[model samples]
Target: MAKLTVERLKKQFGTSIAVDELTLEVAQGEMVALLGPSGCGKTTTLRMIAGFVAPTSGRMLLGGNDITRVPPHVRETGLVFQSYALFPHMTVAENVGFGLEMRGVSRAQRGPLIAEALGLVRLSHLADRFPKQMSGGQQQRVALARALAISPKLFLLDEPLSNLDAKLRAEVRTEIRSLQQRLGLTTLIVTHDREEALTMADRLVVMEGGRVRQVGSARELYEEPRDAFVAEFVGRCNLLPATREDDERVRTRGGLLLSSRRRADESSSASTLAIRPERIAIEPGHHAEIKGQLEAVTYLGAHTEYQVLLGESERVVVTRPTPVRDDPMLSVRTNDPVSLTWDTEAPRLIPETAKD
Candidate 1:
């Protein structure tokens, strides 16, 4: 395993830039996820690192060696493609040993190495099976084994779990995380799923418009987002246009006053007050700090989502655990008057100038 560094990495197709001044570092034995929506350049960034796509400008270092111009086969980076690109005619053992063969390992020497890789993914028994005969999950494991057989300096995965069913996806992700930790592998994964990133990565890099928006742990991104876009994109957030009224207060455009734990920095620009769905509390009466008309109620199994319209236009979603039998909220309906309140520290002030 090796530490990977990218400096001012950029990629462009003609006039359109796919990645813009991207810089990141992945520590040895740590897993970092590149998270963003489709077309945000995450896959492009990964391909650049893996030497599949040449960068327009910038440098990449692996274990203190400059590898920006290295060929893909010589980069010593194992990459698992999104489609699990396994040759249909090859048996699982042959697929796993292909990388070793490319590196000049003889057939006599490749047997134990292939067995070890397949064992790491718990697929040793299926080594004789072909890709077309195995389930999707099994095929994914075979691809992982193939990548692992080469003992790569850097491990890269591109949406490795996207094709699996929900239950299988969860199980496979857990297995991957466990194996990565056990082997102390330095990994970089490109994915658009927030839950997958949050649960699997040691750190997350959130990207938008081909540039990084924020890089931090899941808790830091969710609790202390730097801007409106990061605040809303990382999770469900209620963003209302407001002007800073004081050190701890802001008045929303809809004529409602709210308190925030963070004071807006001394910028006079319009700001946004961000509150999490579960932070706001609602009661049956209209006597609280803010009153709103309940617009809709959605039962989401473990939790209930309430859409409340505050004043003329501000609609906020508040989530709470499902109430027990005889609870008054269980009987609340749409269009009912409700009182909303929250602790002074529940809301955060973010610059409204952040563009999507």
Candidate 2:
């Protein structure tokens, strides 16, 4: 396993930029995910690292060696495509040994490598099956095995589970994470699914508008988002337009004062206060720090979500574990007035002009 480093990487298409000065490092044997919505440059960055796309500027290093100009096949990086990219004419074993063949490995030496790779993904029994004969999950595993067979220094997965059904995605993601950890593979995954990144990665890089917004562990990004974008992207958050009134106080646009953990920056013109839905507690009566009318209640098996209307237009959402049948909240109806409260540290102040 080796560390991967990208420094001030930039890419431009004609006049539009696809990736802008992106810098990140993946530690040896650590799994990191590039997480963001479409066209946010996550895919472009991955392609650049894989050598499929050339960077407009900057450099990349793998294991302390400069690989900025290396060709894709010679880079010694194993990449699994989003589409699986398996050839229909080949069986699983043939697919797994293709990279080795291209690298001039003799057929006599390829059998054990192919078998080991298939075994790692629990697909050794399907070595003779063609791509068309397998399910999506199986095909994805074959693609993974094909990548793994090379035993490259860096492993890359581009939306590896996107093509699978929801249940299959869940199962396969768990399998892939387990395999990556067991092998101590230095891996990087690109995905738009927040849950996938949060659950599978040691750290996450959130991107927007072809630039990185924040990069940290799941807990850090969820609990201490640097701005409104990171706060809302990593999880569900209620972001209120706020103005600094004091070091630890801010007045919302709706005229509600809220306590925050972050001290107000004197030079900033505005701040956005972020509160996670799960952190806010809903009270039965209108007697807490803020009062609101219940607009809706949604029961989601293990948890329930409540949408509350504060003032005339501000809306806040609260999430809690589903209550028992006899719980008082079960009796509350839409339009019922309710109060909301949270610990003083629950709200995070986001500067209007925060940078990555």
Report the Cα lDDT for residue 111, model 1.
98
Q: Which stretches of candidate 2 lie over 4 Å from their true place?
A: 264-270
User: What tens-digit string does per-residue lDDT give for candidate 1 at 1-356?
Assistant: 99999999999999999999999999999999999999999999999999999999999999999999999889999898889999998999999999999999999999999999999999999989999999999999999999999999999999999999999999999998998899999999999998899999999999987899899999999988878888887899999988877777889988777876555443455388889999999888688878999999999999999999999999999999988799888878999999899988788877864442
Residues 1-356, candidate 2: write the lDDT tens digits: 79999999999999999999999999999999999999999999999999999999999999999888999878999999999999999999999999999988999999999999999999999999999999999999999999999988999999998899999999999999999999999999999999999999999999988898989999999998888888898999998998777766788898888776555543364478889999999977788878899999999999999999999889999999998978878888999999998988888778655653
**lDDT, model 2:** 0.91
- The TM-score of candidate 1 is 0.97
- The number of residue pairs in model 1 that clash at the backbone is 0
